[model samples]
Target: MIPFDLHTHCTLSFDGKSSAEDMVRRAAELGVKHYALTDHVDLGDHADPDFDLEATVSGAKKLLPALREKYADSIDLLYGVELGQFVHAPELAKKLLSENDYDFVIGSTHNIRGYDDFYFLDYKEYDPFRLLGTYFDELLESAETADFDVMGHITYPLRYITGDFGINVDLSQYAPIIDEILRALIKRGRGIEINTSGLRQKFGRIFPDEWIVKRYRELGGLILTIGSDAHCTDDLGKGIDEGIAVAKAAGFDRIAIFKYRKPTFIRI
Candidate 1:
């Protein structure tokens, strides 16, 4: 069973449509013991400079307490954020993370160095290999310096590169750099998440794939979290059972959860 969903987006995200209350209620119906409401905050050149995190944080602090009390009996609602591209805005990232005591923080690179979001880019206009190389480069920068609890959807852009662009890029060429990213996270005592959104998407696979998870395990990286990256009610809890299976196949015995900014292991 998929016990908890560690990565989810609610109304706080520009693209998300569901409210936190709705997400938690849906989790209860789905028997998800724990659920995280991880909205987006992209500070890199890709994100709008006008993005207001203070307002979002304030709104969350206001509603979360009541939600927690209401769902106390049925679900564990995790208040979290998906902070993207912190390498481009380290100061702002630190300020937001320092000021807000989040239960979970997911660091991701949704925007490349030149493109703000992978979704907005025209994959046909660029070489897939070079573009993906730059993608990994930026992701490494985020993993190397950002203060986040888990790395969300490591191979996110490939959903587009492989599916939309119909280009097959070999991951072996980037294995060395990928290992560096995993080691960096390992050294910091951080974690990597098994994001299952791609399974429902055209990618038909989880973010980071199986080899990446196994590689992290080989590097002695233990903390693994699972999430659906759901943006709507219907997508909630999607692909999570498969995610746990992937974790087990990668040789993980448990999944990690964050509470009060610390890691807690839960048997999968």
Candidate 2:
């Protein structure tokens, strides 16, 4: 098992099944030395009504510190959030980040402008390639400006487009955009994550694939993080060992853990 998980969800997230306390307790039981409860905080046009940004961040802020103290002896629980669609609402995103105290933040773009999350979209109605182009462009914008510790699930669309719908996507078509996104992240000293949730889901692979991970390193990007992106206690840390192996293959000897929005590297 990996020693830490940087992205995870609890009851604070709309789709989460387990409570924060239960999730933390279970992480300790499984010998996870470092962990984070990175519940979703979606923003702007695509955000649903159920995900109250203030409530989610405040709840995590109020609850996690106490849990961190309670489990101080057994686990190093970090307070974190997955801040989605930061490009859509720059002022709101800046305000939220400035006001809150978060140990880690996963920057993501769940959908393009005026569209639902890829998971909820009807694939038959739209051109997947066009949608992917928009997604990467939006992500590049987010990478250029969003304040985040790491970019979450860079290949998120493939989870549905290829994994669920069985549409074989030639990502090489978007290589230029992908390179720009990676360059933006590297220029700003931000990193990308190897999200392992895809391994268990229909995708059957880590997000962004090994090529992107290696390319990130090749382009002078030094920071990388691994996460299960687990939404429940049972799924926490799942496929994390495989995530580590991928990181190693990508030429990363150390992975990052965030505290106070700054990165600290630890050997894998």
Candidate 3:
């Protein structure tokens, strides 16, 4: 059984609906042994213009100790943040990492040079293929530049590929690029995540595709984490069992957990 959910969002996140205490209570109820609260931090001002970056970091620091004390015995709660990559905001990204001691840091490519097809509301002219290719390139660059503990959803742009966008991801076309990204992550000692939230979306699969996971293993990338990316209590632990099955099928014998920014591998 997969006992840890390393990527999630609580009230600290702008889109998060559940409080930290609520998430802890739900995790305990579901018999989850470990988890992390990885809230979204958009580097590009395009996603959420009203988000106060400094205040978000400050709030996260303030809540960590109490939550840690509250759930210390029953469940292990980790402090983390999900940073969106813009490449231009590398300095801000580094400053956040330097100032705090986070248990985990998730680097995600939410935009390609200030235009995010996924979260942007007025994305009418978005080209899926070009956006995907650009997103992958930016992700690889961010992995090299950003000092994050883990790379957030590897193939995040897939969520917006369907519906009105009329984009279909064949995976075979982007396999080599994804392999290069995974290889870069491995070289930098960063980990990849099995974002279960993707299953709830139209793609009906986790990030990076199953083939990416297999290639990651083939390239000696062992560090992996599973996340529901839940905004509410009910979404907690959703589709994680299937995620574990995917990981096992991809030849991963363990899942990585973080504590005070250090990784500890637990056998699945």
> Which candidate number would show the highest TM-score if scored against the true structure?
2
Ten contiguous residues minimizing lDDT sum, candidate 2:
45-54
In model 2, what are the clashing residue pairs, if there are any? none
lDDT of 2 by residue, 115-194 (tens): 99998987899999899989998999889988898999999999999999999998888888899999999999999999
lDDT of each: 0.86, 0.91, 0.80
In the range 1-268, model 3's lDDT, one tens digit per residue, is: 3398877888788888988789878887887888888888888657576677877889988887678888898888888888877475877777888888888888887777857437563435655777778778887887776787778778777676753354676868887888788889899888888899978877777876777888888999988888898898998998889889999999999998988778899888
1 versus 3: better lDDT goes to: 1
- Candidate that scores best on lDDT: 2
Write model 1 residue lDDT over 65-99, tens digit each, in one string.
67888899988888888988888889989998988
TM match of model 1 to true structure: 0.96
Better of 1 and 2 by TM-score: 2
Q: Tell me each candidate's TM-score.
A: 0.96, 0.98, 0.94
Task: State the displacement of the C-alpha of residue 197, model 2, in Å, after optimal TM-score superposition.
Answer: 0.2
Alpha-carbon runs more than 4 Å astray in model 1:
48-51
Better of 2 and 3 by lDDT: 2
